[model samples]
Target: MSGLNLKALRKAFGPTEIISGVDLEIADGELIVFVGPSGCGKSTLLRLIAGLESVSAGEILIGGRDVTRVDPARRGVAMVFQSYALFPHMTVRQNMGFGMRVNRVPKAEAAERLQKAAALLQLTELLDRKPAQLSGGQRQRVAIGRAIVRDPQVFLFDEPLSNLDAELRVQMRAELAALHARLGATMIYVTHDQVEAMTLADRIVVLRAGRVEQVGAPLHLYDDPDNLFVAGFLGSPRMNFLTAEVQPDGQLRPLGLDVDLPSPIAGLRPGRRVVIGCRPEHVEIGDGPLAATVKTVEQLGNSTFVHADCAGTPIAAELQERWGTRADAALRLALPTEKTQLFDAETGLRIRQ
Candidate 1:
């Protein structure tokens, strides 16, 4: 297996930049996911590594070899695209071995490799079936099996499961995770789905508008983010942000709700404007100073989420059980003093503790 090293990677299209300077390292056998919203350049960066796109500036090193200028086929990598890209006329067995045949690999060796890949992907029985005869998940497995037969140094996936329905996506994600453990091959997957990134990545690289925002383990980024964007983007239901101001007495008032500070931040001195972030799970229904009128309540059997408006600012709280609150009802919730996160209102960057 080979690791990937990208140094100062950049790509531009006629005067417009799509990928800014990006430097990343993927360890051997590690699954690294590039996650961000659309137009964020995650897919572009993956293409650069796969040698499908040329770099405007900087270098790409695979297994310590400079492959920035190498052709896609010679870069020791195989990519699985969002589309299955399978041949409709060919059987699964033939499609999986097509790459090997084109490269002039011996027929016996190619057959053996195809057989092993089919067994690993649980597609041995489907080898005789054409693309139209297979299910969506089976077709995706065939695409992956095709890549596996290449025996590439690194694997590149560009939203390979995006076409499947929600349930199938979940099933395929688990299968891909198990496959990684079995093969121990270095893989870089790109997706706009944060849930996929959190569950599948050994480490996540968050990007925004072609530049890296933050990179860390899933929970690390969720627990402590570099800025408002990373904090709000990583979590489900999103983190809540409210405008606040630091008083002369060094007290923080967010929508008139007093919150204690953990420590003094450089830009958070007395009278500085700041934003307070609270996770829905961190809020609790209790007797507190903050009050709101319920706007909506969602009961999902095991849990409930209450959406409310406090002095025109929206706040949400998640509870283990249903609260049965009606619209326009009054409710008071307490914010965990320690769990609240503060960000500089001007720069939107977190105030490190």
Candidate 2:
């Protein structure tokens, strides 16, 4: 429906800046996710876009119109918050149609919108039920349905599934994806859960502190991160980092193991300290130059995660097969040259070739 733009967007409380200058263009009908750790300004940014928080300095354009100072109700956007925020006394039908009623929509139009949203969210059968009678997932659906009836140009979800159980969260995630596809509405979602961002977003905007670190398709950012933080943050079990020093012949010595640099990096000089990174899946076990002591073994049913200590450096490796390996056992691990990443130790930036 509508594309959203932030030009030098910023927000501050008192003298402390919470959202720094951020510029992003979200295409019409695109589902963009803002992901980061707690207190990383993801929620602040979302609130700013919703007009719930005043912008400290910057411009917000929605559907090509400047709405930086517009009222929240007039911004053509609807928000589903972490809490359901439903009126316990109101039935699903009444709650979903409350906004329409407040806006003086025609009775017939409001009824029609309610029916359509209920049917779309599979809440048609629960219209007469109150929030107290509904399950967590059902209540969340009611909240989303309320937003849907508004027919907003953009939809903002602020960790809407965080309150649900693990199984319900997974179910709701799939349902949300389906709903997005059906409506084709522009959506901005904020979450600290990287799994949610990876599975739900058309593109992910990774944030830290109050600044955007990287914005791209999920896999793109995962495979080609621009900095060490992005690489370490996006993956489960996280990437393994080992301190190393560059040798004259493009080789690196990490933890008494010699590994050739993955690629030629510009500005890399001999004796420069660098960090070598390898994902769990890329760390081959049972055969390589690096010797480690197994610290822990996690049996995840289908796969195993081996955490080891190599000369005081911790490393984890994922194995397709179940290993009978126990703690305190010695193992050799290898870091494949093609799969390894190099980073500047001082700057925590990727050493680009």
Candidate 3:
């Protein structure tokens, strides 16, 4: 029953609006991610839900009860921030149990809660260590452990892994996913990283300019996006957009490559201009209608990324095996008819059949 519901949520800082007209529902035990570029209000929305900021309008409900005006401490949730926020002088055990101690929770209860959280987070071995003695990952674990000890109905993470190194971020992501599975507690996470959003969330809320651009399961949004912003934003290395125009026969000529539109875009007619989107992995490097000159090649052991120029538009193609093409080499590219996406040139919306 610890689900979250936002009804026409809005937030304004004095005269300027930050979060505008958002409506969403997060089911109990779901790990939902709020992802976007910096200043997109993802963090602000998380704060609004956590009761850290006053709502300009609308209502916030958690576990079926309204808590718009409730104090953050009174809400049945715990938050972990980007900063570890650990007490430098305190041991891991002490820091984890501090909240309960301040609330005058009995000594035995606090100790038990701390013990359980530490065990869950694999911090039992480091309980005696101080923040100064621990690495970034360990400090983060302590922070998360502190939140877990509270036994809140929901957990909020505000880019908790951003401070960690690349290797540690991957480790923490796996750990957090495991923790979510084990606890089955409702969680809301905010991050500007799309990879984290795709790998960590059961559903992702993509934000832009203080508004939600789209929300859905990660792959659903990746495979079939609602508009150009989402299609370009959700994928790594980004989806490619090449200039295209609808032919008199209803086929599309995208970067001089002819392809039939998907079944969903049946309404598009001749003489209309559109953008053709193809993910890097979808474009085949072989003989086809389009020709490109490789401008750069990225070799990453298991795969290769070819950056090229087709006419004037930049194109990126990914290959699973090793590629021998070097800079300035000529290559033919093919866009599979079934794998391409069409968007209206004027509105920047996916043109569906």
Clashing pairs in 3: 264-352, 264-353, 265-352, 265-353, 266-353
Q: After the best TM-score superposition of candidate 3, give how far the Cα of residue 282 lies from its true spot, in angstroms.
A: 0.8
Relative to the true structure, candidate 3 reaches a TM of: 0.96
Off by over 4 Å in 1: 255-267
Candidate 1 lowest-lDDT run of ten: 258-267
Residues 3-120 of candidate 3 have per-residue lDDT tens digits of 9999999999999999999999999999999999999999999999899889999999999989999999988989999999999999998999999988898998888888899999
lDDT of 3 at 252: 73
lDDT of candidate 1 over 63-102, digit per residue (tens): 9999999999999999999999999999999999999999
Error of 2 at 42 (Å): 0.4
All candidates' lDDT scores?
A: 0.91, 0.93, 0.90
**What is the per-residue lDDT of model 2 for residues 258-314, given as tens digits with 9 covering 90 to 100?**
455443354578899999888999999867888899999999999999999998899
How far does residue 327 in candidate 3 sit from its true spot (Å)? Answer: 0.6
Question: Global lDDT for candidate 3?
Answer: 0.90
> In every candidate, how many clashes are there?
0, 0, 5
Full-model lDDT, candidate 1: 0.91
How much is 186 displaced in model 2, in angstroms? 0.4
Worst 10 residues of 2 by lDDT: 258-267
Ranking by lDDT: 2, 1, 3
